[model samples]
Target: MKRDKDALTLTRRIGVFGGTFDPIHIGHLVAAQNAMHAAALDQVLFVVANQPWQKEGTREVTDPKLRLLVVSQVLRTIPGLEPSDIEIQRGGLSYSIDTLNELRASHPNDELFLVVGADAASQMPTWERAEELSTLARLVIVNRYGYPTISSILDFDQPILAEMPWLDISSTDLRERVRDHRPLQFLLPETAIEAIELYQLYRNRENG
Candidate 1:
């Protein structure tokens, strides 16, 4: 039977995985899968942030449209996962507070689980409207191999630590590899790699 794309509206437990997704990699998928299983989420929303406020001016990211396309393409290969254009549509720098608020408004009765890396969780105290995050959605801190298990850093009391294997792949390193013409082999989805090569993405930082 064919699954309905709009069925996310009826979900009870949602996992919001927001990222630049410079190009959706396997690590992103593994982490989301771990979070979904650990939290028993109804579905995971892979939101592509238009402008990552944290990385702003520090590094270069692929064009928003290309990033979104890559994320959307990989998402279709998996069930129980969907790509969201909430931040891209909203425009400007993406903020967790804003995304959570919008989702809460749309899914008032459903429970929202916001997925974050351990590093991101550590800086929650300084986020815009940080205190209100717990009210908007339960935070799930995904574990990394080197980073300490650190959900308690925030005063919010509800952040749960998801102890999952750390997939050492990162977008920054991935981009560097692309610039160096390194083999992407198993790092990212085959289709995504083909698209990147076909379009010559990341070969030139500014253009990428």
Candidate 2:
């Protein structure tokens, strides 16, 4: 697929993949890559959330700097994977609507696609400024474990939803496996797993 150019003459067929990315893992990369190919995206921006409203005060995330470093390292091996600090620099409750709006302003002529897991997609109606968000970009939902009815959540004709293969792996599961001293050889990207072990993250947190 040919990439659309931005006002600055840069490639602009970008896909936005936002998440805590407390520790970037294989599952996250898999979904992003799959969506990139399936949607014919030229670039995929991995937006690491500084603070996620969904897990507000309930979960402890690794420092944004560390998270950003890990994300950068993980994406270094994957072509077309770019790490974005939009949410981290904004600092506060990171809302999808706000991020999409910012992207729209930055790339006015480019088309934006938001990639999210099925569980989050199922709860789109309850999101802040959800209706406005639907108009901001197309939502590409990836099926994950525990969220089987993703197709039923589309109440509007906007925010086109496309289904992809289900990836059962999750950061929560990776954390638990680490805490239990279990092997995570295939569960996450080698670089990501190395970073997790080096940082010793998610060892004390309970499974989500």
Candidate 3:
């Protein structure tokens, strides 16, 4: 895809994949790659949430820096995957509409694509400024295993729902496996798993 070059050259087709990435895993990578290909995006930015408003009672993420590190490590192998600190730098409850708006402002001529899971797409209407968000960017909802039907989401008007390779993996399951001292060899990329082990995340640690 050719980027639009004006006074300042700007990549016109960019995909924004926002997630908590408590521990970046293969599932996240697969979805992003699939969305990029399906949407013909020039680049995909992985926006790690600084504060996920949706996961309110889900225990404040282990550590944002650690999560960012894991994301960086996982994205290292992917050519077009770019790790962005936009949400983290903003420092507040991360909202999709706000992030998309910020990105749109940064690249005035570019077409923004917001990548999301089918489950998220199903409940998008309830999110803050859902209508405005829909207008700001084209939503690319990746169909995950066991996701609800797309028709249920009234907010997504003529949204792009792409069928990607299904990988039954999730951060929640990964965290549980870690907490239980179970093996997580194949759940995530080797680098991501190594980073988790190095940081001793999820494992009960003594602190003074």
| lDDT, candidate 3, 21-96, per-residue tens | 8888878888988888888888999999888898877575766777888899888878999998899999888898
State residue 8's C-alpha deviation in candidate 1, in Å: 17
Q: What does candidate 3 score on TM?
A: 0.89
lDDT of 3: 0.82
TM-score of each: 0.89, 0.86, 0.89
Between candidates 2 and 3, the lDDT winner: 3
* Global local distance difference test of model 2: 0.79
Q: Tens digit of lDDT per residue, candidate 1, span 110-174?
A: 88999888877878888888888888888888887777788575555567677667678888778
Clashing pairs for predicted structure model 1, backbone only: none
The C-alpha stretches of model 2 lying farther than 4 A from their native spots are 1-11, 144-149, 152-163, 204-208
TM-score of 2: 0.86
Give the better candidate number (1 or 2) by TM-score: 1
lDDT of 2 by residue, 1-208 (tens): 3445444454557799999886677778888877787667888999988888988888677788789988998998789999999998899988888999999999877778888777778778888888786687777777654556465455544443555556677787777888899998977788888888788777877747
Error of 2 at 206 (Å): 4.8
Better of 1 and 2 by lDDT: 1
